[model samples]
Target: MSPLNMFSRLKNRKSSATASQHGSLPPIDKPMPSQCVSSPPVLPAATMHVKQSLQPAAVMQPKPATAAAPKPGSTDTVRSVVVHAKKLGSGAYGAVHLGTCYSTDGSVHCVAVKVISAERMRLESLSREASILKRLSRAGHPSAVRFYGWFSPGSKKVSTDATGPELTNLEVSHCLVMDRLSGGELFEYVLARKGLSEREAAPFLRQIAEGLAHAHSLGVAHRDLKLENVLISASPSGDDICKVCDFGLAYRYEVDGSGKVLKGRPLTETCGSKSYAAPEVLEGRGYDGFDADVWSCGICLFAMLAGFFPLDEATGADWRFERVKLATQHRQSATRTIFSFYDRPCQLSSQVVDMIDGMILVQPNRRLKTEDVLQSMWVIDDTIKADYADEYMYDEAPRYRGQAGSFDPNAVSGYGGQQDMAPLYRGAPAGVIAAPPPLMKQLAVLGQ
Candidate 1:
């Protein structure tokens, strides 16, 4: 069966009872809230099993836009830009449309214009997102989407009624221009393929890891990492290149202060797709943005390989919590059960299982960091070896050093030279690496 058909069947199966009571699913275009509240406390390694209460949502009131001088390298101003009538997609903030930008020399280029309504999004949030995109653009990672510029249409151009004016004449509150990825969303790509083999999925996963590693190295954390947010490139053959996009929930976790790695105040806003969120995030505890990103990556990888979520709320309960509960009951058995949840038991290799295990561990402190993931056995296996060896495999920018708002592209070279690991093994030799302590403790806790 086609992936779309299969997904429809699965979705129908999950929501059938609810549908009978409520009629049907809500409209797809329903807008989500603009802001969400997060708690303050990092999930320490020692208290892995403790449950935390959910925090109240913190609403960030809209702030008026301030008039300020444009910073160096900022494309805050443009000579002429035209947004096309074609709508690419829409979300809580706004809709995206195809656009054309013209330069002083009369050069024209196609771009994606993300238009946000003035009423729904706060100016502060828009500005923050713009800054993050600029930083990502400066970092120059191949897998990161390129940022063009942003603008807001004047009142003369905006129309409140659809019958009042054409879309071209409608005034927008904020418009961010970026390179248009023609291959569409990663979710669509996955749905088209149904499920991918380990070999087929490795390169895409590696590119995403490299992108995240580069972002983390620069102290940026993508709080909302999921299949939907990833954009696939139009590749003629082999796997399509994945570009990390949609910085709506992304934040910089560290400040660039004279070569020092200074931590910014921890983010306390709980926002992200629930399925891909780290356990701590769902529990309403303050969490490391970087660590949460790694957890989400693990979830994405699981979906890619299994063609279904490792744990789904629609499955009648919180799958993650249940998995933890099962692991507490029987550690080894639980791990195997979770891994085999989706049919295709023999398809996964030991290294693949180990890598996922390390990534999605319940303990945030014990979860594999982006750097460790890049070096993981699964990522380095033969399937992705050539791509891994490519010059752009790793970002070369210095993590926390550079002038404010400007990156020195030549400041650093390749990742510190590291030798390749020996050929892939079926699994690590017994006792080569010990099992995680947290998992063992959970088993003990449940036994009592």
Candidate 2:
């Protein structure tokens, strides 16, 4: 009796193991306890049950994912998608990585994912950028770097390329998804060439002024205007265009109905790279952000033309800056005040010096404005001007369907509560700049 019972049990166990060899599945009648959670996805096989023999074949199978019928959390839904590949750059707040994303239309694209730490940076910081980028992206501004959607992946697991303060709320968040500016940073671009000639540099300046004009026209001030913050990207024309990016320190100023920054209510925040900061910003005084941006532009122009920074820093403590300050206070000319520090300076034309002095003036009241920048001798008189580069910045996926003519606000990221995002593609780039070309020639050359 004992031998018979033992033999029967062993045979039963062997049959059970064989049945599961083809797949790790529970018996039809006794599913595992884990197959209960509703939110997280479950295997189709786990949920499969024998249907009635008379039921139709279509009811027994799953439908393919398309706009007509998409599963929950499907590609049609808003997602914070990122496939971490390699590190691109990092900052005090977090790191930026190259990532792959699947668009709603089933297209795959390479996107720049900026992973930020909430502990080091506020959610508002990224939100503000998204807001500004949404506006600029809708206009399809070629001189400004485009922004994709931002997401906070509240996951306890650290990402392969994620680096910042330890995760707060047990998850790391992505600040924004953006088009990869393949041409690299402006600092590296200029440094590689050891500087650019006035003829060569004029294009870059013209593009920058155009971008700045747009931002000013929208009542936005790029507080952190620096070489590192600006990027170089190629347009469809294969000419490199300087695109202003990194709007983390960007400020939204009070504006009139026309979107111009209003006077009187000066900004009190002293933010921006030290070398590029205006004297008022350094002195902790209320200053017009638009005016400060112009001052920074002057410094950038000087650096590009001379292939070196005009001064290490713009504070009175820096002797070189102090000389410029003294000269400015004395109403001296920009050439004598700025070039005096160099033993042998490049021959910058009087037009160049005057332009620099126009914005780099000591007093904010008399500082050059952004609109005036485009009208400057080298910009307006120059043969180049930046045309609008339009693209679908808010599509659920990359809009490769080919939109022609003006931007259609109906298809932007802000539409339908979608996050801001756009893929870099080769589009004709027009306007005032030229350099070694790089990624995404997708911007449409408008009014060319």
TM-score of each: 0.65, 0.63
Give lDDT tens digits, candidate 2, residues 250-283: 6765555665555444555556765677888767
Residue 308 of model 1, lDDT score: 51
Tens digits of lDDT, candidate 1, 1-448: 2111212322232232111010111222422222110111111222112121244446332221233423322473345566777788876567887777665566777778788877777776677788778778877789888887666656322223233233643464567888888888777776555556676678888888988987877777887888878888766675478888888777665445553334444445556665677767666556788888998898788777655555532112343345444443333322344533221122355455556666777667766777767766556646422232122212320111223223232332222121111111122222121101010000000000
Off by over 4 Å in 2: 1-80, 155-171, 256-264, 382-448
Give Cα-based local distance difference scores for all models.
0.55, 0.53
- Number of clashes found in candidate 2: 15
Please report, as a residue range, the 10-residue window in candidate 1 with the lowest summed lDDT.
439-448
Candidate 1 is scored at a TM of 0.65
Instruction: RMSD for all candidates, in order, please.
Output: 19.5, 32.3
